[model samples]
Target chain A: MAAMIERINVLIQYKDLLRELVVRDVKLKYRRSFLGYLWSILSPLLIMIVMTIVFSQMFDRGIDNFPVYLLTGSALFEFVNSSTHMAMYSVLDNSALLKKIYVPKYIFTLAKITSSVVDLVFSMGALFLVMLVTRAHFSLYMLLIPVVVIQIYLFACGLGFLLSAANVFFRDVQYIYNAFTTAWMYLTPIFYPIEMLDKMEWVRWIITHLNPMYYYIQHFRDLVLYGRFTDAAIFWGGWLFSFVVLFIGLFVFKKTQDKFILYV
Target chain B: MSEEYIVDVENMTIRFNLASEKVDNLKEYFIKLIKHELMFQEFLALKDVNLKVKAGEAWGLIGINGSGKSTLLKAICGILKPYKGTIRTVGTIAPLIELGAGFDMNMTARENVFLNGTVLGHSRKFMQEHYDEIIGFAELENFQDVPIKNFSSGMQARLGFAIATMVKPDILVVDEILSVGDYQFQQKCYGRMNEMLQGGTTLLYVSHDINSVKDLCDHAIWLDHGVVKKSGLVEEVAAEYMNENR
Candidate 1:
């Protein structure tokens, strides 16, 4: 308990450092690029167009507002995907700084996730643009979007902590995570309707019940596309998954961080 | 735990495990572990080391290459954890372990000053107030907008040193950062360090240049092979160290 409070105190004391690091990450990401920050919105919009063209015919379950449906799901998943990937490399990328200074080790991972959240907000503009173009339903429930995003942020932070700490010891975590995310993206139903697996009830059940991302993406779609609040189970499940993963991530990271200087 | 000592390290031991074989990936490491084939040779970087520093005192750490001089500085900065002991420090620490460690080369010099300042735990408002002072001290007034990558190495080091000493920290831990710039800049850095010392900052400096160490530090420690060979006044330890090298 004392350690936990001390950690929080450190976080508070270094909040300014965290902000600067996030700003640096966001800036350096777009530096020297011709399109610069435009790519954040454009890349997702372009992916939605291609995926809509290719997968629209194959998995057309007569879902209304397909572009809105696809964009909402893909955008949320992309946040988790990109944030974790960036967080995974956070420690190793800052190895030089880590070896010299005493900044909290988890601060690097936190900064990466925060910067990716900035990108997520930008990509969200693309979602709204697609909604306007497609003339999708608009409801008061849209304000709940930030709540879902915050939940997803917590979930990604947990995974970020776990992966960044693991990466310090095993350089192969990056490659393995790359392959895992590809499989995870397919499993999350970003481009397809979950009901398409109706014939395989067990598979559908596993994806809906077991996968944490499914709850977040589903809640996001419910709010943005369907104009309704998520079911109680999913609403609570999203929070549960986020806190549990965050707890586990913090536990593992604290256990392993002391050894990080030796490896990094 | 006394208030007099600004830095206290007691019987600290830092150990590293040198993996007998290089295992870069998870699969190979797990396989070796399952088969009990993973071997490690224990290496002690610093064993049973102890040091105490009072406020407003300057101490120099001198040793040959691989003699744990850098390791000791790192341990004091809390970058490396001790395997078998405790380290307690009072007050803020400004560690210039290596200049430019926190710099983003792609960022402009002006941006880096803010970034590095925040990394050292200064508030954004404080950085804003001291922006011109830091820039002026580094003497890069005309190059503020240029990316750090475009700056020469000496320029980068100067910016790093300037930002690090901008505030008088309670404890300053420097590790050979003064070796990068030209002789004139080195003198300038020494001058700034001297000013901070006069302001009652405890300094722990590591340098191979004995003459400069003697000039800056009142007391010194000679570390040889992770052990304290001799430690006393600057003149006594410096003479012993020079004689042994001769």
Candidate 2:
């Protein structure tokens, strides 16, 4: 308990540093682009357009408001993708400063996650624009979006801390993660409805019960598309899964961080 | 004069275990692990070192290249963990090691000031309160809006030094970062260090220049091959080191 308080005190003391790093990341990310942050909204909108043209004819029948569904899923997943991938290299990238002074090592990962989450918020502009185009209904269930966002954020933070620490020892982790994300995208049913997988009932069952992103994404779809909360079990289950991954992430990060200076 | 010890390092040792054969990737490493082919050779950067620094005293570390001067400083700054021992320090630390290390080359000098200041654990409000003072000291008011990449290395070093010293830390760890700047800026940095010293800041300075050490520090330690060879009055230690090396 004392250790936890000390940790929080450290975080509080360095909060300004954290804020500055996040700002630098967000600004540096879009610095050279002519469109600037517009790209954040545009990239997802463009991906949704392409996916709509390719998959709309098939899955559009099964999934209502297919564009909005794809937007939310892709945006949420992109948060995880960019956050984890960027955080994976945070330690390696800041090796110069890390070698010079003592700043909490996890701040780099936290900074990466903070910037990616801000980007996710910008991508919401694209999601809402699509929702307007589809003339989606407005309801109080949309208030629940923050809950889903928190789940995704915690889950990404967990995975990011885990991957960033692992990458310190193995550069190959990045390449492996790149391939893993690609496969992970297909399994999450971002483009197609699960009903489309009728022939593969076992795959569908596993996705429903086992996959974590499925709950968060489905909760998003439930709120934005169908205008309702998910089953009570999935809602609580999503939070549980998010915190569990977060716990493991912190555990691995704290365990491996002291040895980082030696390896980095 | 009496002394109040503010930094204590007790029998500290730092060891690095280097892989004998480079395993290029995780796959190769795991393969080697399974086959029992992984080999490591341990290198000690510091061997059972002990030191104590009095509050507000300037201590210079003198050593030849690769003699663990920088390693010892890093260990004190908590950047390098010792293999065996404890370093207890009773004050906030600011390190000027590899100056401008936190800088983004593409960002303007003004932006980097805040960025680097916060990286060093200074609050944004503190930086805001002292931004002009930092710029005034760096003499980069005209170039504040320019990207640091375009500045000469000396100018960048000046900015880094200025930002780091904006707040007087209780303890300052300086590597050989000042040598990159011109002689004029170097003098300016020395002036600031003198002022800081006058205000009761303890300094752990590492430099190859014996003259600067003799001029600035009252006490010195000469390290050779990962161990302290001699330590005492600055002039005596430096004179003996210079005489032997010459």
Provide TM-scores for the models. 0.97, 0.97
Which stretches of model 2 miss by more than 4 angstroms? B1-4
- Tens-digit lDDT track of model 2 for A44-156: 89988998999989777777778887887888888898899999999999998898888999999999998998999989889999888889997889988999999999999
User: What DockQ does every candidate get?
Assistant: 0.77, 0.72
Fraction of native Cα contacts reproduced by each candidate: 0.75, 0.74
Clashing pairs in 2: none
The TM-score each candidate achieves on chain A is 0.97, 0.97
Docking category of candidate 2 = medium
Poorest lDDT segment (10 consecutive residues) of candidate 2 chain A: A58-67
Q: CA lDDT of A152 in candidate 1? A: 96
With candidate 2 superimposed using the best TM-score fit, by how many Å does residue B29's alpha carbon deviate from the native? 2.0
Regions more than 4 Å wrong, model 1: none
